[model samples]
Every structure is written in structure tokens, then in C-alpha cells.
Target: MNIDVPRILIAATQSGAGKTTIVSGLLAALRARGLKVCGYKVGPDYIDPGYHRLAGGEPVYNLDTWLTDEQTLLNLFARTSQGADVAVVEGVMGLYDGGAGGVSSSAQIARLLGLPVALVLDAKSMGESAAAVALGFRDYDRRTDLRGVILNRLGSDSHRELVSSALERIGIPVLGALHRDEMLAVRERQMGLLPAEENGDRETVSRMRAAVERGLDLEVLLEAARSAPRLSVPSLPAPARRAARLRVGVARDPAFSFYYPESLSALEERGAELVFFSPLRDSAVPEVDRLVFGGGFPEVFAGELAANLGMKASIRAAAASGVLILAECGGFMYLTKTLRTLEGSVFEMVGLIEAHSAMNARLQTVGYVEAEALKDTVLCPAGTVLQGHEFRFSTVEPEAPERFPWAFQITRKRTGATSLGGCAAPGLLASYLHLNLLGNPACADWFLGIASDASDV
Candidate 1:
């Protein structure tokens, strides 16, 4: 909290309440005002944070209590917000929506960071009832500081007057009222919005920026942000773990881009050299002893990846050669035998594992998780405890029913559906779960142990 950045949490009453749309515009507006802006997402979402970075020029950091401990979350917020004028944290689903225990929601983060909240209420149809939602959220949590309210998708001047009068009757101040606009919404596919990296057309991105600028009132939002006080908190000490003198290959491309910058930095801090490569473009894995694949839109690039026969073969060879590998959601899909897109088009993938994944109508895995390594692999020592989240919309179709590999046992940390688990092949570990190793420092020791053994050179 020695950091001098003034921060505010952009939260809402529930999901689909237009929080992302409103927060993105606020970020773009602040950047336009010549202020150094940093954005943070309150949960483990890969897509929404991408748009935040596109507007603010900084990779969005995830703050979640279920996946990471309170201390690590605080330090991540403090350390990442260093040298920033202000920090804007966009909340997940709803203000209080979290996993099974409902303990790690956005409101928890607000109290933990001692930051004020500006609730974005969707007022397309509701009138005075919007005030009830705002008040309920404000009074529901005594510890949370509900500073003000922003009415999004408002109908007209008369509509705003009705909603404003109701909020005034309560104690929450009305900051701004935004009218609904179709053009202001960014396009989303199965997973969510495409990461800014895949959006090739700068004009389209700029047009989205312009839409955001014109929809929400920037001045009012910035004023609300400025009203928030600075936080004075302690920093988290670096995790105590062993180091390994090995190079780990990380996937970086249009297909696999949901990697947290901190995860890679943690590996380096623990003495592992990270070599980034693109599975979509590169014909082979880097000359490293291990591999780490994060999440992204592998479904969109299915055909291209299928055509990249050389890359697929090279990955298979690497696994066969006993290279330690860790693949997350999208990375996990890429290592399968094949991947089917939403349009029924299939692409060939590395056959290191026996499964074939296909896009489904519903997201298969989503939310925080606690995974224990069933076997000693690249990610952990045998029986090591691991914490992470799983997010995917695809299901695997194996050639043989019993051939499905389950090398790890996964338990959902919060309230969400259960997942199958991880797969293993002598030094390789892959799963749809995305884990931030800083919380559970043991992962560093586990990964290093595998990397050290594989780095026999």
C-alpha cells in the first residue's frame, strides 16, 4: 500500500449487467485524459482482461481469493500497481458471486484491498427498482465501501431522472447514466471476446475505442475514481522454493495467449529459463528441456494448426524424448490428437495424449480449482498440492473409453461443476486448468524438480 495509486472497484449487482462494457470505456477514457491507467480483473477470466489491456496498454492481473491466498493477492495488487496514477479493478460475474464457498467474490477483494466500489447497474427496463438493487448491494456487505452508482443502458432523460431520484432517496450518489448502444459491444465467440492480439485490424479496435468513448461519460467516472483513497498495505514475500537450471518452452501466439506475466516471472525468479515459441507458426518446439502452454483460442485456429503437420510432429517428438511439459486449457487441447471448432471443422493436433477435443454448445470447465498431482510430472512432485482454475468450452472424444488419461485429481475450490483431471506421459502434464503458482509455492519446487531431472545436459 506504499504505492500511491488511487484505485476503485467497478462492480455490479449481477452478471450480464454490462460491467465489462462500462469499465472498458472508463479505462479508455482515463487513458485519453493523459493519465497513467492500470486495469485489474477480479477473477480468472482470460478474455475480458484482454480488452482491458487493449484500452489501457497493461496486461490485466487477476485477483481471486479461491485460487490465490489473500497475502499473494494483496502483493500482486500492490506490486503491479507500483508507479501508477490510479488502478481500476473490474469485478467478475456479480459483486458477491464467487465459487462454492462464496468466499472469494469481488466484494471480498474490495474489503481486502480497502478500496471503494462504484456499482454499475443495468437500467434498461427497471426504474425505481434499480435503486433497490443498488441499496441491497451497498448494505448487504457492511465492510464494503459502496461509493456511488453508474446506471448503464439507460433509456432516456426521463428514465435517468426516475433512477437518479430513487438512488438519491437512498445514500448512494449517481455518478453517470449511459444510454445503450449496439456498436459499443465487442464481438464475443464461445469462450468470450477475442484477445486484442488476434484482432488484426487496428481500425476496428479504434472504432471500438471510439464507441466506448462516446457511450460512457469519462469525466464523471474519473471523478469517482479520484474520490477513492490510497491503500497502505504490506507486500508479500517471494515464495520460498528451490530453483532448477532448465529452460522451459512457453506457447505464445494467437492460439495460446492467456498466460499471466507473473507465472512466467515466478519461473524465472526460481531459476528456470523461459523460452517462448508459437505452436501456430513455429515448426518445432524450442531447444529446451521443458514446456508450458497457457490458454487462448485454439478453436479459431483449428484448421491452421491442423495443417501445421511439422509443428504437431515436433511436439510429439518432444514428448516422446521425455521433455517435461505442462499444458493448460488451450495448451491442453493443442496436445490432443485433434480439435473440432464450433463450425464442425476439425484440425489435427499433437498426438502426445490419446484424446480428441471438440467444441461444445456449453463451456465444459470454468472457475477456481485445487489440483493434486497424482503422479510426479513437470508441474509438481508426486502428491504435491496445486491451486489453479479451469476454463474451457470443449469436450474430449477418446478413441477408446478406457484410454482417457487421468494423472491428476482436481477439486473445484468454489461452487462449480467437477472436472475429470490431468493426463501424464512420463515428464508431461496437461490439463484444462490454469494455475497461478505464486499462491502455492510448492509448484515452484515441483516444476524445478522435473526440469532439473530433464536438464541432464
Candidate 2:
């Protein structure tokens, strides 16, 4: 399928280049101009995308090449960006860093979508030297057309002038050089930044709003957007496979809302009805053959979740009865026996799986992962291959040996081996690893396949 979606990607030389602040400000400024702008994050990042959503009233999506195939990624990008004037994609880490060994970087995404790159370079400590960095990034990839440069965190007006002058020699337009502002500092936690949900305090939200307004050059960013070359692709039709299953219950709320829209759409394409229920408020699991619980902040709401006896008991009962359950990080924690907060408080969770999760003051798993199906579960049977990423700060310690074997063996994108949790018990596929459906479209069919087969139960 093809779609003619006009888009631009906000990339960077590397992490800490102020991409978040720049993207956030750009999105806010565009929305303030009353433009219908949709935001897309380049990889499986939960935190940055939260800020993106807050900056604009658009739903955020993760686009990855290694985890999701090219067709699925484009299809999702096309589908989500439909009916919008422009699509703004925010790059992850660096413009070129992807999974292990330089694959699946943001450059890969920009190339795949045929979108221009707006590189944000940190120009605080550099002068004419900034030209070398811009030239290197532009020439290094060759295929990834870097359209413009955004000099971030400038020291002074003279500092901005120096960097902009250097970049001009290389023919890259400087969108704008933003002055370094301490007030633009967003609060941070073990994970990159506290999610927008957790930081909804009136003072904090207002502060963030004001910071973007003051720190960002909105007029300059819009000019950059206007200067972006148009991208044209054939209109691709949505997948037309008939629905294969019906009424699949999805776990949602602030605690479990990390699902990709493509996942639900794929299921719907195969004839599965998607239903959402809040584990935090629902008294019981929705009456459906399949249960899907994606990732979110179960650790932060551990106490309230543990005290939700009705919902906890219902979820446990559903899992124990062999109902197809597909749970990710936060959902993985919800099915466990207990959750230990950073403050040393332990709250009881659903006892469907004999495991306990501990919230640490630091992150436990970060970055992309490759996971192959080891055994039959809700999503796939033995030997089914899958690629995804796991981002979380909660650590799980299994209580009983042989109670639940890991669902898949994890190989990190850049590093060697990474740890993950899974259960072999009938009708359960839960893990800390969150898979973007765009990367693995097969997950939808796998989930529906198992759920449809379980209609008799």
C-alpha cells in the first residue's frame, strides 16, 4: 500500500542534543498556529512520545525499521498521518544510532519514509568546529538527506552567529539557534523523563508550557517546516484481510497504554473486535476470549493496583482459565504476585504468575531487543520470531522455580544478552519486552490465532 503523506523528521547528531526540547517546542508552536500536526517518535521510546503528545493533541506512534518491516512501518505512518496537514517525526538517541552495529537508526527511518531530516546539533561548546560535525553527518550516510540544522543550547548571540556562520559554509540552513535556558529543563527520573501523566500538576504543567513558549523560536521552526522538500508516495490501501477473531480485550489506562495502533488495526483487519478495559478501574476482565495488556506505569500505581481486588481477581481468574493473555511490561507486573516500590513497600498484585516485581531507583532494561518465540503462547507458537524493545525501571524476581519459563531469549541490539520474563503456563504470553506492531505485524495474527482457537473454552 502507498500513501502520499508529507512529513519531516527532527533528527540529531546524538543524544543530549536537545532533540526533545526542540521537537516539543516545534510541535507546540505548530499547534499554536492551528495546524493539524501529528507527531511520530522514531523508536520504542515511551517517555519522549509522552511529551510529544502533551505538546500537541495528536496521538504519538513509534516507527522502527529493525523491529518492524518497511511495509508495515510505512503503512502505519501513512495510516496515522492521514487527514493531517503535516507529520512531524522525532528521532531517537542520535540521527544514525539504531540497534546493534548501526542498523535501524533514525537515518534508516528517514530513508525508508523518504522524509527530510532536520538535524539538531548541540552548539554550546563549539564554534566553526560545528561545520565539521554537520558535514560528517551529511556525507557519512549519503542516502539520508540531511535538509537543515538546528543549533541548540547556544551560549550567547555571538555563539549562535559563530555556529550558524560555520554551518552556512557547508550549505546547511540553520533553522535557528536557541539560547541555552535553564528554565527549559524538564524534570527527569530513572527513565529519561517523568511521563506527562505523572507530571500533571498545575504548576509543573504550566511551567513546561511557559518554558516551551520562551525557549523555542516558533517562527523559525515553521519556516524550516515550510522549507522541507515535499515527499510523494503512491496511495497505499489499508490491509484488507478479513477479520479472524472478535472482541479481544485490551488493557488500557495510564498504567497500560503503550500499544501501537497498528496492533489493534491488524487484529481488526483479521476480524477481531478490540475492547479496552482499565485494570485500575474495572472490576473484572472484559468477557472476551483474548486479553492484551501493553506497557505503562504499573510501578507508579502499584498500591492502587494492588488494592483493586476485584480487577486483580478477575485477571487472575481469566489467565488461570486458559484465556489468551498478551501482556507487556506494566501488564507483566500486574499479573505478578507483588510489586515492591522504591520506598520498600510491597503491594500485592494478581497472582496469575508466580513472580514479584521490584521498582528500583534506576532503569532495569533499555534499548532494542530481538526475541524469538520459544514455545506456544497467545501470540505465537514455538520458534516464531519477533523483534521489539524493553524500556522499564521495575525489576522482577520470580518466586517459584519452574512455575514460569521465559517466553523468549533476548539478544540486545547493540549489547550482548539482555534479561526478560515470560511464562509457559497455558494461554499466557507476558513479558517486560514491549514489541512495536509496526516492527512485528505478525504479532496481531499470532494473538488472534490463539484467541480464535480458544473460543471453545
Candidate 3:
């Protein structure tokens, strides 16, 4: 099957080159022109997609080759991009930065999907030397289609002219030039840009769209997107029709908002109705067959979550009644007996797992991990392997580490170091590892299968 979806990748020379701002602005600008736009982010990032959703007014999707295979990633891109005039993908870190051998890099994604690349070059310091940096990125990998460049953080008209002329001389088109504006800066915290849900304002996006409209060449970007070749991929079989026999409550407040749309969709496709409830604001958990706690900043809102004693008791009671529960990262921390904030303030959590989590001054781990299930669990059986990623600052300590039911043998991809992590029991699996169920559909099947059986009881 061949599909023609016009798309462009907005990548950067390195991190902090204003790719998020530019992409967000571009999405809003395109929508302002009455064009339906789809937004995507490369690699595993939950925060940027929040801004993308705000700007695009649609659910943003992720494209990661590490978490899923290339075919699966392409299928997701094609499926989500339907009915949109154009798709704008925000790249992660640098164009070539990824796991070992550039597995999930923006450059790899661009090449794999045949998407045109628009490099966002940080031009804060140098003038003509900016062209040299852009040239290096363009020439570094011939396979990557470097269509044009957007100059960010420019000083003056003269600066733009100098860099534009240099890039033009090198046969690279200058698609845009944004002057340095302090007002356009997005607020940041420990995990990078603060989630847009917490921003709670459209003024930032409005300012970004105005700047992009004043500086960028929208027509040229459209032309580059239209230049993308048709993507030929295998057609996916229609999903089997099945009635939703189980209800799954999902934690989805500002404090627990990290979830993959595809993962949730996978559950829905497998005959599970997802019910979203807030642990911070809701008084009680909804009656459901299973519960899911995704990753988020639970430590930041520990006081609020702890204050919701009713919700905590409801979750604890549900867990004790043999309700299947799955929690990852922030969700995992929320399931512990206690959570200590970075400032030494401690608060009680759901207390389903006999463990305590404490926020550290620095990141504890951040990388791709291959998880091999050590024992039978609700999601998977023993010896099942899944690909996922872990990024967190908090550390979990089991009250009785030696007696804890460790779920998986996690192996870091870069170092190959193995460690026993997570807590698993008959109807619970709580861990720091984040998995995209689209890549591991069997796990989703197993999860829903168990939920259906438990519902029957």
C-alpha cells in the first residue's frame, strides 16, 4: 500500500536550539492558515508533545525506533497523519543523537520516513560561521535529506543577512530567521520544559505564532513537505470487532499525565474501555476492572496527592481486592508507601507496594532498557522480554528488598549492566520502565485478557 502524506522534520544541531518553539509555532501558523496539521516528537518525550497538542489542537504522537521497530513507527506516523494536510515532527536533542549506532535519532527517522529535514541552527554567537555548522550537519550524512535551515536566536538584520548569505552560497536555503526574543522563551524546570498543562496559558503559543509569521517562509516549508516521496508500507489488517468487556481506570491529572496515546488505543482496540480519573483531584477511584498509573511529576504534587486521602484509600482497597494494577515511573512512585520530595518533605502515597521513593538531586537513570520478566505477572509471563526506556530522578527502596517480588531483569542498552527492579505480584506490576504497547501488543493482550477474566469473577 502506498500513501502520500506530506511531512517535514524540524531538527536541530544540538539540544537547546529552539526546535520546540519553532515547531510549536509552525503548527499553530499552519493551523491559522486553515490547514489541518499533525504534530509528532521523535524519541521518548512526554513534555514537548503537550505543547504540540496545545498548538496543533490535536493529539500528538511519538515516533521512536528504539521503543518500536521501524515498520511499527512508520505505521503509526501514517495512521495518525490521516486527514491532515501536513505533519510537523519535532526532533530530539541533535539530529544524529540517539542510542548506540543512532538507532532512534531524528536523522534515522527522517531517512526512514523519507521526510524533508529543516535544520534549526542556533545563531546566537557567530555570524557567517553558522553556515559552517549547518554544512557539517548537512554533509555529515548524505542519506539524510537536509532540505533547508531555520536560523534561531539572531542578533540583528545584519546578522541574519550574513548567515543567510553564507548558507545561500553553500546552496542551502534559509527558510527562516528568528530574532532573539526573551518573551518567546518557554519556562523550564528539572525535566526540561515545564509541561504545557501546567503553563495554563495561550499567550506563549500566540507569541510564538506571531514570531513565526513574521520571520518564517511558510510557503517554502509547505513546498518542502509536499516534496516528500510517497511512503509505501504494508497495510494493517482491520482490528477484530469485540465488545468492551472490561473497564480500566487511568490516572490522568496534571500530576499523572504521561501516557502514550497509542498504548491506550491498543487497550481500547483490545476490548477495554479506559476511564480517566485524577488522583490529585478525584475523591475516589472509579469502579473498574483494572487500573493504570502512567509516569508524571508525582513528587511535585505529592502534598496534593497525599491530601486526597479518599482517593488513596480507594486505590488501596481496589488493589487489596485483587484489582490488576500497572504503574510506571511516577505512577510507580505513587504506588509506594511514601514519597520524599527533593526538599526533604515526605508524604504518603497509595501504599500498594511496600517501598519508599525519594527524589534525588540528580538523575538516577536515563536510557533505553531491555526488560526480561523474572516471574509471572499480570502483564506478561516469565522470560518475556520487552523494549522500553527509563528516565527518572527518584530512587525506590523496598522496605524488605530481599523479599520483594522483583518483576524484571533490566539491562541497560548502552552499558549492558543488569539489575533487578520493579515489584510484581499476582495482580500488580509496578516499575520505572515505560513501555509502548504498540511495540509489545502481546503484553497488552495479556493485560486485557487478565482484566476480562477478573471482571468475569
Candidate 4:
């Protein structure tokens, strides 16, 4: 099927070039014009999409060619983009930064979807040299549709003109020029921008929209988006038609908010109804057949989580009764016997797994990984292989390391290094690796199947 989804990818010359702020502002500005806009992030990032949701007033989706194949990615893009006047995608890092061959880079997505790119160039120090940078990016990959440039952090009107003229001489259209304003900045911490849920303030989004309205050329940007050719999206397989026979409790709060929209939708499509409950604030776990905990900032709220002894006991009782559980990253940290912060503070966790998690001074792992199931588990059968990504700043130490039932033999895609990770038991699997179920739909089916059997028992 061929679909014409007017889309534009807001890419940057490099990281720290303010593309997130620009994209968030653009989404708000477009929505203010009474246009139904959809927002997306280019890779496996969960933080930036929170800001996108704040600005766009819609749930943001991810588009990653690494986590899933091109066909799946295109289908997801096409499906999520339905009923929208335009789609705005925020790129990851620099345009060309990704895996070994730029597999999941913003440039790759632009070329794959034939989307026009409006490069955000930081114009803090140089004037005409900005053109050289834009020229380099434009010619670096001829396949990339570098349609225009947006000058960010301009010092003054004169500065904007100085840079805009230079870009014009090289035949690059100047789409927007935003003056440097500290009020438009979002706070950051170890991971990246603080999740918008934590910083729940509509005022910040208002400032971003006002700034974009005053600085950007919305008409030109829309024109560039409309210039994209109609995409040939492959037909997706029909979802299983079944009534909800299983209840899956999903942990969701300020501390546990890193879930993929499609991953949750996949479970619902396979006869499971998701019931989201807060692990930090709720005194009792929701009555459900299974539980799911995705990655988030559990360590930051370790003290609060530990203080909620009732919630902890509730989860423990659920696990003891053979309630199947799946956790990743922060969710993995929460299921351990204890969590130790970087400041040497220790707090109690669920103790479902006989392991202690400790925050490290630096990141322990950050890359894509391939996992081969070591044994039969709720998610998959033995020998089942899946792709996932891991980004964490903590390490897990098992009480009896030699006796731990490691779930998968993980191979780091970038380094080819092998490691034994994840804890697997009769009805629980917890790991630091994050999986997108869209790429592993069979796993979702297997999970729901196991949950159904457990509910029957």
C-alpha cells in the first residue's frame, strides 16, 4: 500500500545541537495551528519521546531499523502516522551516528522513508562557517534529502542574518533561526533530559511553543514535509482475533515509565488486557495474571520504593504465587534483593532475585545485543534468539553467582563480547536488556499463552 504521510526529520549537525528542544517546539507550534501532528524519535530512546508527548499532546512512537527490520519500521511508521496532518521525527545524536555502518542513524531513516531533512545547525560561535558545516552534511550522503537548515542559538538579529545569508549563497534554504534562550532549556541528569513526567510543567511546553512561533517558519517547514514522496508501506500481518483472557499488570509511574507503545499494544492484540499500577505509590499490586516492568529511573527513587514496604510485599506475594513477571533495566534493578546508590546508600528491593544492584560511577553497558535463550522461559522457548538494546549505569551481583539461572547468552553486537546475564526461574525473567516486542511478536504470544495457563491454574 502506498501512503502519503507528510513527514519531516529534524536532524542535527551533531549532538548537543538542540534538536530535541527544536523538535518539541515545532511539534507544539504545528499543533497550535490546528494541525493533527504526530511525534516520533528515530532510535531506541525513551526520554526524548516524553518531551515529544508533552509538546504534541499525543503518545510518541519510536522508529528504529536496528531493533526491527525496515519493513516493520515502515509499517509502524505508516500505522502510527494515520489520522495526522503531519509527522515530526526527532533524530538521534548526529545524523550519521549509529551502529558500525550507520544502520539506525537519522540519515538512514531519512533515506529509507524518503523524508526531507531540516538540519539544525548550532550557530553559537561561527557565522559563514555554518554554511561549510551544512555543505559537508548535504554532500556527505547525496541520498539524504537535506532540504533546509535551521539556525539555533543565534546571538542577535545581525547574527541570524550573517548565518542565513551564508546558507543562502550555497542554495540552502533557511527555515528557522532561534535566538538563544535559557528559559527554553530542559534540565538534564545522568541519563539525558529528565523524563517529562518528573518535570510535569505545562509552562515549559508553553515557552517552547511561543519560542518556535516567534522564531520558526512553519509554512516552509510544512512545505518541506509535504514534499516527501508517497511511501510504499508493506502490509502488516493481521493480529490474532481473541478476547482478553489474561490480565498483565504494567508498572507505570514517574520512576517506571520506559515502555514502548507498540510493545504494550502487541500484548493487547494477543488476548491480554494491560492494567497499569504504580509500584511507588500503590500499597497493593493489581490483581493480574502476570506483571511487566520496563526500563526507567528506579535508582533515583530507590528510597521511596524501599519506603513502600506494602507495595514490596505485595509484589513479592504475587511472584511467590507463580505470577509470571518480565522486567528490564530499572525494572531489573527493582526486583533484586537490594539497590545500592552511587553515594553508597543501600535500600531494600523486591528480593525476587537473589542479586544486589549497585549504581556505578560510569555506564556499565550501552549498545545493541543479541540474546540466545539458554532455556525454556515464559517469553520464549529454548534456542530462541532475539535482538535487544542495553543502556545502564549499574551492575548486578548475585548472591550465589555460580548457581544463578542465567536466561540468555548475550552477545554484544559492537564488541562481540559474550556475557551471562538475566535471572530466569519458573515464572520470572529479569534482565538489563530492553526488547521491543514488535520485532519479537512470537515472544508476546508465548508470554500471553503462559499468562493464560497461569490464570487457569
lDDT of each: 0.77, 0.75, 0.91, 0.89
TM-score of 4: 0.97
Model 4, residue 54: what's the lDDT? 88
In terms of lDDT, the poorest run of 10 residues in model 2 is: 448-457
Q: Tell me the lDDT of model 3 at 377.
A: 80
Name model 1 segments beyond 4 Å from true.
1-3, 199-232, 239-245, 401-405, 414-419, 450-457
Candidate closest to the true structure, highest lDDT? 3
Clashes of 2: 12
What is candidate 4's lDDT per residue for 101-157, written digit by digit as tens? 887999999888888999999999988999999999999998999988899999999
Q: Residue 388 in model 2: shift from native, Å?
A: 1.3
| TM-scores for all predictions | 0.91, 0.88, 0.97, 0.97
Ranking by lDDT: 3, 4, 1, 2
Q: Model 3, 1-457: lDDT tens per residue?
A: 5547899999999999999999999999999999999999999999999988999999999999988888888888878888899999999999999998898999999998898999999999998899999999999999999998999999999999999999999999999999999998999877789999898699899899999999999999999999999978886764442455788999998899999899899888878888999998899999998999999999999999999999999998998887899999999999999999999999999898999999998979998999999977878878999999999889999999889999999999999999999988668999999999988877887788733342222
Q: Give lDDT tens digits, candidate 2, residues 106-214.
A: 9888877777788988888899988899999999978987877878788888888888888888798876667787766677776677777776643443444455566
Candidate 4: segments with Cα more than 4 A from true spot: 241-244, 450-457
lDDT string, candidate 1, 151-254, tens digits: 88887888999999999998788877777776666667777775667755544446555655765566666666666656666866555444437787888998
Residue 325 miss distance in model 2 (angstroms):
1.3
